[model samples]
Target: MRQVLFLTKIFLKNLFRQPSIVFSSIILPLVVLWSTWWVTADLPMTFELANAEQDVSSSMIDVHVVTGSLTAMAITAGLFGFIITNEYRKISDRLELVGYSPTTTGFAIFLSLFVTLSFSIVITVFLANFLAAPKDPLGLTLAIVLVSLIYVSLGNLVAIIIPKATEGTLILLIVAFIDLMVLTNPMGGGVYLESWTYYLPGFWPIQVALEASFLGNASVSTMVYPLIYFVLTVILILFVRNARARSTMSFLSGGN
Candidate 1:
């Protein structure tokens, strides 16, 4: 336990040391979205989602815009998860050399992600609430944080499978673009409400956020689905990453 804690502390320090990541992942993305949201206050969009239809008002627009911003943040967090884990491959090997088991190191990596997501959800929700507080603050924030897990796990999966940074990021970008369309549907196509859309990880949180911020009448399914998806996704990614780590450790031991 102490070993895991020590490694997690070091991992966090390295993760936050990147100024560009801080700006790109957290600061710059939110700022641009908020600015656009401010400019479009008068031009509010009335979206007829799967469950609720938003009315045209500054508050309604704020909720819609902030929800979209949260989507962008989730995507960013996931990509950073990819970059951070990929960057640490060498250090992970060194830790193994020093007798830190794969399980210990793996927990540390996930602990860092948990910390990142917690801070991210808090700050972004605080900012969104400043524009207009959701009727159910607790539920909205929890849903946002929970949904981010999907992207984070996706990133970890990508890092394990794809060795090239360029390829991994491009893949995440394309996948996130599709998910964003499902969540926002700025085209007014209403295609997102189709049966196929509910299968998406983005759908659950987006639906829950819509209900919490606008109608305040989310179904039980909305609250439950994201939890199931997030847990399953995280569990699957951990097993895959750990298995890969063990394979790599074995190879390293053989070489020594």
Candidate 2:
């Protein structure tokens, strides 16, 4: 327990030192926020006023863009988190040689995911808040956290399967872009309207974020996706880890 915490702490502290990590945590979200605003500048802004006699409504397109932008940004943050995880893997490898166990590695990886991805999400929240003035701050934050952590776990799973950091990141980036653009498209009612698009990465998270932030609409069912993805990620990492442990044992025993 103590060791897991310590490892997690180390990863958190080290995250800020990396320029790439810092860029993802700070500049990426800002850029996403800016681009979303730039592209959707023509859209209407209809927010409620404090006056009891009035309620405001705006272009649904505007709302959709704003929500979709944040969802895209969340996907970007997760990709960046994957890059950081690759770096952390070097440290984990060394630790594994010295007496580390699966629990420590698993916990540490999760902590790293939460910490690194959370940094970017925080930036997104602050920036998006100013632009969209999200109605439910708590819901927005929770949605962002869920999306980021879920993607972080995903990044770890990719590391296990591909092993080559650069190749894996590249593949994940392409997939994320496709998933965000096609599945989470703002215009809606197009190719992505298929039932399967709902199952894609970033789909539910985006819906959760959009509903919570813009429409001020939410449901328990929305959260089900992120939780399901997280569980799948855990299972994947364990399978990969167990396979690696077996290989290590075999090597130690002279492949006999």
Candidate 3:
């Protein structure tokens, strides 16, 4: 436990040392959220999703703004997860060489990200309430957090597999823009999303956020689906990381 704590402290210290990262993790979300809110403030529109199940749709346009902002926030969370894992890969190897367990190091790195994400969540929800308050703030917050967790796990897995920062970032940005900004964005053509979009990572979270914003509640299935997806993603990440490590070790030993 102490070893994990010590590593967590170091990770956080190093994380805050980078001004660009700090800006992205904190200021960037605010900028995106505010910009979204500004553009839609005058629209005063409502949307009923195709094949709708609920009457309380995104009516105020504020709900749309909130959902968009939350998407941006989730994207940033994922980016942070990718960066921390990528930047600290060398240090993680060194720690393992010094007798630190991989599990402990991994947990510490996640802990640092969780701390930063928690702060981002609070800031996002607080600002959204002032600009576009949800009908059920608590539920919206949960929905947002779930989305962020899913993306962060994804980001971590991508970093492990790709190992190239620029390429990984490009992939993340492409997915985020397509899934959240285009497909799930009620203000745009999201109402006509194809059935296949249901499988996208951003789908359920936006549904839940819309429910919370306009209806004051979300369905059991809506909430549970994201959790299930998160668990599956995490399992895949662990499996991939372990397989990669084993492959590296085998190659180092010349396939002996």
Candidate 4:
């Protein structure tokens, strides 16, 4: 535990030294959130009730806008996964030469990325509430945390497999585009995802956030899915570390 904490601190110090990573991971999300709010501020909100008049309440409109904005925020948070991956790629060899175990080092890297992503999510939620004043403040807060965790986990998984920084960034861009343009598009029936879509890490958090923001009650199961993803991600990271360690030992023995 102490070793993990020490490694986490080292990771954070490394993060702080890189100004661009800090900006990308922390500042960029707020910029996107602000842009979203600006664009949606004037749009009319229309809702079709089951058996009543189509009411156009401003508050209802605001809820829809905020949910979309929060989705953007979640995407931004997920992008940090790529940043961490790139950082690891740059330092992996150095750390390995220094005798640090891959598992400890990779986990430390992830912890730093998680902290920055969490801060960005908080900023996004605060801006959303300040600008629009969500009806259920607690629900909105919880939803943001859940959504952030899901995207961060997804980002971590992506980082683990992709070797090149540019490739990781490109992949993240494609993912963000598909998630917003196709999966979460209200016009394309975002509410009714196929069974396979449910397996997507981004799906549950966005669903929970949308439900909490607009419907006032998000399902408990939807909220639990992201937490499950985080656990799985940790497991995968540990597996990668163990694999790398074994490979190193084999190479060393053969060379000797």
Candidate 5:
């Protein structure tokens, strides 16, 4: 635990040293939220959500926009994942060479990500409430947090696969824009969900957020999609880590 904490501290200090990273991971999301709120505040847009109990419908514009924007926040988390993994790959490798285990290095990476991502999510949710209070504040926050973590896992995979910050960041942005904005947001022509779009990455998390924000509760069926995706991402990350460790050992042993 001490070693994990030590590495985590180092990771965080290095991360914060890059002003661009701090801006993108922390400040950028807040800017998006404020921009979204400002744009949707007076667009005469009201999303009609079916009530859980009755067959009635309620029109919610502000909360809907806020929740939609919350999903976009995951893009920043993904960027952070990509940056941290690729940028610190050498540092983590050296630590393992000295005395740290792979597990310790991986845990430190996760811890640093958790610290930054959680802070971003919390502040974003708090600002969302300040803009337009949702019926279930905690539910909204949890939904966003889960979605962001899922993207963090994705970012890790992308870093491993691409290993290039510019390309990885661009891919993440394009994916988020298409999946979250163009396909999920009502203003972006997703007022009604098509069956096929459900297979997309951001669909379920956006559903969870919508349910919590307007319906006041997210159902189990709605929450299951993101959970499944999150599990799959974790498995992929573990597999990659194991492969890297084995490859390193093989090289050190000189093909023995």
Candidate 6:
């Protein structure tokens, strides 16, 4: 427990010392959220129907717009692929040589990064709600947190595989584009299959938020999928850390 706390402290200290990293992780999200709200402030709430006689209500339309905006911002900020990749490049060898177990080190790094993500999301949501006053404030807040966690996990996984910072940033940009342009589009012209969007990690949070805002409270079942995704991410990260440790030990033992 003490070791974990020590590692966590060390990770945070190192994280905050880097001005660019701190700005990107914390300030970037707020900027994106504010810009979105500003640009969309004049838009009126209206929804189209394919063949139905009735149009969706203004409340529903507003909800859809807000949820979509939040999801996009969350994905952009929470996807810290470049940040983690840079950290690994700068410190992976030093960490390995310092006698710190890879699993412990990875967990500490993840936890510290998660804190920054959480802070950014929460602050942005607070500002958005305070200014515009979301109809379903509680639901929007919950959705923001869930979406942030899901994308952060995805970003972390990307970092593990992408060796270069530029490559990782490009990968995250592509992912964010796919998520927003393809998966989250309700117009049905996205790249993903119609049914496959439901399986995507960010889908449910956006869905639940829109439902709650536009159509009263959302179903409780909406929470289940993101939780499962979160658990699966943690497990996968642990496995990756353990695997890396084993490979390192083998190389050292073989004198290579």
Top candidate when judged by lDDT against the true structure: 3
The per-model lDDT (C-alpha) reads 0.70, 0.67, 0.77, 0.65, 0.75, 0.64
> In model 4, which range of ten residues has the least summed lDDT?
47-56
Error in Å for residue 141 of model 3: 0.7
List model 4 lDDT by residue over 1-256, tens digit each.
5666787888888777878865786678777776666665364444322112333245434654565555666567567776676666657656765777777777777777778676777777788777667666666777777667656666766776776777777887677656654565442354436666666656666666655555666667767877887788778867876776667767877945
- TM-score, candidate 4, is 0.82
Instruction: Write candidate 5's Cα lDDT for 1-256 as tens digits.
Output: 9999998998888777877866877788888887777665454544533224433233345755555556557778888888888887888778878878777887789789878777788778888777767777777777788778788888877887788788999998788777777776555654446777777777777767777766678788877888898888877887887688778878998968
Model 3: pairs clashing at backbone N, Cα or C within 3 Å: none
**TM-score of each candidate?**
0.83, 0.83, 0.90, 0.82, 0.86, 0.82
Cα deviation at 75, candidate 1, in Å, is 1.9
Instruction: Provide the global lDDT of candidate 1 against the true structure.
Output: 0.70
- Candidate 3 residue spans exceeding 4 A from truth: 49-52, 57-60, 99-101, 190-193
Mind giving the per-residue lDDT tens digits that candidate 3 earns over 1-256? Answer: 9999999999988888887865877787888888778776454565654334655444445865777766777789888889889998888767865767666777787778888778787878787777777888887888779888888888888888888999999898788877887777665574435777778888888888877777777777788888999989877876776666567566767987
lDDT score for residue 3 of model 3: 95
RMSD of each: 3.3, 5.1, 2.3, 4.0, 2.9, 4.0
Candidate 1 Cα misplacement greater than 4 A, ranges: 39-60, 183-190, 249-256
lDDT of 2 by residue, 9-97 (tens): 88778776777766766677677666766675455544431112334466654565456445556566557656766766667767877
Ranking by lDDT: 3, 5, 1, 2, 4, 6
lDDT (Cα, tens digit) per residue for candidate 1, span 1-256: 9999999999888777877766756675577457746765555455555655454233446655646655666677678778877887778768877878766776788788667666666667777666656776666776677667778777877877786899999988777767764434433246757788788777777777767766655667678888898788777776876787778777877944
lDDT of 6 by residue, 156-203 (tens): 777776656777777777776566545754422444335667777666
Better of 4 and 6 by TM-score: 6
Residue pairs in steric clash, candidate 2? none
lDDT minimum window of 10 residues, candidate 6: 47-56
TM-score of 2: 0.83
Relative to the true structure, candidate 1 reaches a TM of 0.83
Which ranges of candidate 6 are over 4 A from the true structure? 41-56, 59-65, 89-93, 96-98, 187-193
